[model samples]
Target: MLVPLVIGMSAPSGLEGGELAAVVARGELVWAADQEGGGPHVFPDPDAPQRLTGFEVELAELIAAELGVKARFQQGQWDRLPLLLGHPADCVINGIELLPERRRDYHCSRPYFAYGLQLIARRDGPLDTVETLTAPGPAGRWRVGVLTGSAAELFLRSHPELEVDAIGYDGTIDSLEQVKSGVLDAALMDDCIFNFYADRFAGLRAVGRPFGGGYYTVLTARDTPRLSTAIDEALGRIIADGRLKTLYDRWDLGGRQQILALRDAAEIPVATRRSLRELAIETLPLLLSAAGMTVLLACLSFPLAIFAGLGVALGRLYGPAWLRPLLTGFVEVVRGTPLMLQLYAIFFLLPKVGLALPALVAAVAGLALNYAAYESEIYRAGLKAVPLGQFEAAVALGMTKWQALRHVVVPQAVRLVMPPVTNDFIALFKDTSVCSVITVIELTKRYSVLALSTGRIVELAVITAILYLAMSWPLSLLSRRFETGQEQRP
Candidate 1:
């Protein structure tokens, strides 16, 4: 088996040093961004699906030009961008806030942009400022939305009274959309982002004063002081040359954050290191909720996969001749592609064609469809193992083909396939973690955010492994029991 060299205690990009010279030598500066971080920042160009266009995309190009290297884009989920920096990526620049935890592990550039949180609400909505909503009235409790891991979310999470049902979304667009749809009372995010995205959506208005501001900086690993310096110098040059203002003007983002970036850089606050015990106390409920989501996904997907697999197998084996080829191709096609791509197609692409599904539904459907392909093959093998002679004898005994296969052939085949089927089920259990790409938060996404925020990687990881093990071990034991019983048969 091949093992990844970068796994375990691996340093962040540049932490080993010389990240700047290495990018120049390679003739490419790999900048990581989550295009799903959404528009006005980074997102797909609707006019041209193959192209990407956003304020960040243009800013990256300017930075790369200053450094004399071609800029290359590497996409990662917004929450996972920091973790990706040390791996092949040189840095992350996608509206990443200068959080305290980031400063401890990463060396960040001077603040390129400063932004305050904007309160987004329906036009003529009852809620306004924190004061109006927090006071005793019919509006005392309101459902608000925030982007997960943003300062807005942290602020809301920090306030128990002000955040009655603060809905967390993976991106600014998702949260803002919820507000426009009346699914949420309001949403909060960078004021600049709200001005760019919310205005176009209609029925939503930015109200109340902007609050809880933070700096956006490019993040590099701690090992490369030179790379960190180079990034700061590049940003300084960008600001001095008025190129930064040009980009911001196009995006209509001029504010105190951009002003601070133009003047002397803001003094970044030193990070207060968190203790493991504190992290455990804070993260316990988060992990438990995520584990519940993981279990929910597993329970929901496996049964659907089992039924879908059964149907596809029967179609391949006993259906009409013309339909058999179509079923065969579907099984082959789904199995041939990666599950991640399938989920992306369902969650992101489907909405364009007017088949927008809720996150949970899309996640379950994607997992079930992908697993059904593999499960179909397993069932097919079992059906073949029943032998042609059994079918002939059952027919001779005056049983119709459907009746014979259902009662005798299928029953025997099911026993033959139980061991492999159980193993596939276990594999399916782990794969559910990928559903977070579509914004369905599960155990893995929760662990990542907690690990980055709490800075208790080793402890959280061990507990997470135990959580996964606790889920899978029982199934493994049951699988072994069936295998042993079969072997012991006379």
Candidate 2:
């Protein structure tokens, strides 16, 4: 059997120096994912690809370099990483907590970094500190926004008596936006994240002190001991030599000394980290569920496109001349516009026009309609490619026009169109990422969400791209088979 691949290492934050060095020395490659807006692990750097750069990137590269391997990165939305584990990456980096439930499924590295939640509020807001918000009666009802899947979010969820209105946003920037716009009275995030935003977003400040110590550990496959050991050693070395601190300073995270101090104090025992294999195991099921949606959408939409394209082709080719223009116009409009725009219009805008559809239906409809237009052209070309001599031959044989066209013209036309039509479906499958914007929750959307949550953009994106390739590769084989069959036809 092939040696099981060592795929990912979920870090506490985005790639910083240590993680990158570890991967480099071990000759292990890594894929990094990041949030849509900068998360503690991931951030938007104008110079980076897809506008993402952060601790995750630096650490992932360092680890990869230490391993003598390559480091790649990706961008995704938060709240989706757990669902993307195993399918797209080996594990995510960033201080992922080792919960009892998660421990059963995932193996975790020794704690590398630690931090705590910080409450932030606008300069002119009502509450300045966590204590005031926790103080007396009605004031406790003040809304607090927290990025979903963060430690702060989990803390808020566990304490219902606090009476804080908890809103789960996908990114720190979004949570900050709610606070800045006065939509939320305050927001809670990691101290490093709060500091990053407080400086970038004017009129916002970190209030009171940080709360609840949390350690950051690398999450990986529960069964992969060799991979886990390699990464742990790399991380340990990086921490010992002060490379990790260099990264902290580079990102201006050195200012959060207290946060780092807490991490050092609460370090989880090495034996405990080793015992946490179960945490990584459950991750696969969740990721597979999301991957299933991706496959389902692609499969369902493709057949619909074939039928819709055929109908459209018939209309354009055989319908009345006046009707042809209308059919042609419809195809043109769909083909001309971006599929992403179509998905949004169908999912978000169409509901306003009294035509509401579920997110999945809208996604399927948008993809099918978009591909049908391209398919129609392929079909039309196929029809036109049928020689006039075939019709003449049919007439000479005393066959009816309908019978001749159906038996002779269509079969050949279908054979001719098969390749291009197949190509269109492959393209459509990849393009399904656009549906993620409207919450269709397909592969791309899942990857995007996972990236945002874990700040491992490169890894998530690579897995997503691979998933697309896996789907397309089979379709390509089928297309080639059809082409071979066509050639063999008597």
Candidate 3:
């Protein structure tokens, strides 16, 4: 099975080689960050989308220059960027918060930026203030969005008494868009991020004062003490010499908040490492919960794919001449495009045509439609493999064309396609992970979140792989049994 092949790759490498020395020898400081985080941190220049420009981008270069190396950028998902440390990247320079738990797992550089959670909502919305949000609104629970695995999410989750329905998004921009569209009552994000995106979303306004303040520090692999020390020194140099101030002012972030970066930073103690068993005990529930969502998506989509594929196959093979080419084109188009693009169009672009779907529904529809095209080709071939003589024999018994095709031909075609159809269902379990882009939490997404938070990539990945195998193994056995039964039949 694909699961075993993937599980074999989950073993992580050790940090035996000196991280800082390697970077110096190469004359390059490779830093990882998520450009998708957007704005004052790091993002593509709006005027020149191909060129990335942000304060963090400049900050990375400054630190690299101080260390006598050129800075190179490696893109990764925001939450999972830490996983790239000690391999392709020496340090992570995104707006990663400096938390005690984070310090425990990774070496964090001195503060370059200070941020706090900024609550945002529609102008004059019901949940404009934190007090209103704390109280039960007309909707009973306020639906608030936060970037998943981020400090804002942690802050919101810390207060269980708020009774808010926390929705996790992959990016702050998406959460803002949701607030604008009235899908979310509010969104909480880094104050700098909201400031960066404020003018773009005019209808949304900052709801309450920014809270849960923290410093943004560059993170290095735990083993890279030298590299972390170098980064901290570089940050101190930048702050003392006013280069950090110049960069902040250029990015419109030179405000009272900038003072936090200037002050003597307090050292946060590292957290105690959790044993593998303890981590599994703590995170398994979250992963299993997410797996349930994955199962729900697969179960809801695969049957629709099968039925829709059947219709397309029948239309191409036996329907009117005028419609055959249209069905052919539909299948070709669906198969030609990427599933991600199809999902993006359905979830993000459909709103333009007044057909905005909820994230779960959109994910299921995208998976179903994409798989239907492939299944149609399989069904088409299976239908074509049936002999023309069988239809004539049925007609010789005075059966109508419809009755003959249904009673005589379809059963054989279905049998021919069953093995492949079952295999597709098996694949769907893994494919559901892609739905995370649209913010439908599934196994893979949950693994990334848990791995990032716990710094236990290998352990969580193994567990996640096992969960995926658990899901698809039964289907694999069933498909094999069905194939063997077919082989034995006379």
lDDT of each: 0.80, 0.68, 0.86
Off by over 4 Å in 2: 1-28, 37-40, 48-52, 135-140, 255-490
| Per-residue lDDT of candidate 3, residues 1-490 (tens digit) | 2343235334342344476777889899999999888888888988999999999999999999999999999998888788777666789999899988898888888788888789899987876677777788787889898888899888888898896978888777877887887777899999999888888999989988988778888998877777888889988898888888888888899744596554955777777899888997899999999999999999999999999998899999989999999999999899899898898788777875777788899999999999999999999999898899998999999999888879998888999888999999998888998898888888898888887788777777789889998999999999998899889986
Every model's TM-score? 0.82, 0.52, 0.94
Candidate 3 accuracy as lDDT = 0.86
Kindly report which residue stretches of model 3 are placed more than 4 angstroms away from their true locations once superposed: 1-17, 261-266
The residue-level lDDT of candidate 2 at 445 comes to 52
Where does the lowest 10-residue lDDT sum fall in candidate 1? 1-10
What's model 2's lDDT at 201?
77
- Candidate 1 Cα errors over 4 Å, as ranges: 1-29, 43-53, 61-72, 119-146, 162-171, 174-187, 198-200, 207-209, 240-243, 255-257, 260-268, 319-333, 336-338, 341-358, 392-402
Error of 3 at 239 (Å): 0.7
Pick by lDDT: 1 or 2, better one: 1
lDDT of 1: 0.80
The TM-score of candidate 1 is 0.82
The CA lDDT at 407 in model 2 is 85
